[model samples]
Target: MTKCRECGKILPQEQRIDICLDCSRKKIQKRFRDDPELKDVFKKTIEELRKPENVKKMAEDTYRIVNAINEMRDGR
Candidate 1:
């Protein structure tokens, strides 16, 4: 048996999802529907971040962060 990643349930190899089936349907499908406030906030944040100047800044920041991770992995 392997542990389900989301709900920490013990399941047989052939029967396991990252989350159990019940959680999969109820949580993944309906969770966003249940959180209108969070969805609006997420939408507003993404719209702000998608401006041309902000997009470039975000890309540069992500590149620098990934470079730092690779350096650590390579012991540099």
Candidate 2:
């Protein structure tokens, strides 16, 4: 067994996550289950972003969205 790096909780040997696993799962499941519009937006965005011609733009957009999400979480 080892300790989780983020929360400093004891975890089983097979569980190698750094952060709070249960908290991450709960937030992921809740977002996927409850955010229909966001899901559709992601689906469409993925399709558009997958094209070879869109690679640079996709990277830029990915960074922007990730930074925005991080900021939102930090604010909370």
Candidate 3:
């Protein structure tokens, strides 16, 4: 059986990642609660990413990266 890396809870077979969902949520919550600077930066980044132009750019960048990876794999 798979186990959570942080809490040692037995993970379901279908779960791929080492950390369980509960531990991931707790880690993110603790990080935001403990680090004000990171919290602010994360909030700002979220706001920026929510903008329409930024969203489009990010999508385009992701598409480009995927195509590049595909090309490299085909070339191999």
Candidate 4:
């Protein structure tokens, strides 16, 4: 079994990546936090995502996606 390089977590048999998803996510977040430019961009992006208009749009999009999945499952 493959193991995560950073956390030593055993990876699934078919997983091709060296690191587990959780550890990779943490590493990416740490990089964004440590880099000043990336930190600012990430902060701004999060702020934009939190805006009411964006939140509403995201919710609507999620609903549409779920409905689409349901339709597909129902053979529509």
Specify the highest-TM-score model's number.
4
User: Cα-based RMSD of the predictions, in order?
Assistant: 14.0, 8.6, 12.0, 13.9
lDDT ranking from best to worst?
A: 3, 4, 2, 1
Question: Candidate 2, residues 1-76: lDDT per residue as tens digits?
Answer: 6765546877655554443455444443455476454556555766887899976555345434444544655776
Clashes of 1: 0
How many pairs collide in each candidate, listed in order?
A: 0, 0, 0, 0
lDDT of 3 by residue, 1-76 (tens): 8788789999767655566656765654565675455566556655776688776444333334334444644776
How high is each candidate's TM-score?
A: 0.32, 0.37, 0.45, 0.46
lDDT of 1 by residue, 1-76 (tens): 6665668977556552344544443442343475444445444654765788786444334334334444544773
* Model 1 lDDT on a 0 to 1 scale: 0.49
> Which stretch of 10 consecutive residues in model 2 shows the poorest summed lDDT?
19-28
Misplaced by over 4 Å in model 1 are 31-76
Which 10-residue window of candidate 1 scores lowest in summed lDDT?
59-68
Which digits, one per residue and each the tens of the lDDT, describe model 4 over residues 1-76?
A: 8887779989777665666656644654655555445456445655765778776444334334334444544773
* TM-score of candidate 1 on Cα atoms, chains taken together: 0.32
* Top lDDT prediction, candidate number: 3
Clashing pairs in 4: none
* TM-score ranking, best first: 4, 3, 2, 1
2 versus 3: better lDDT goes to = 3
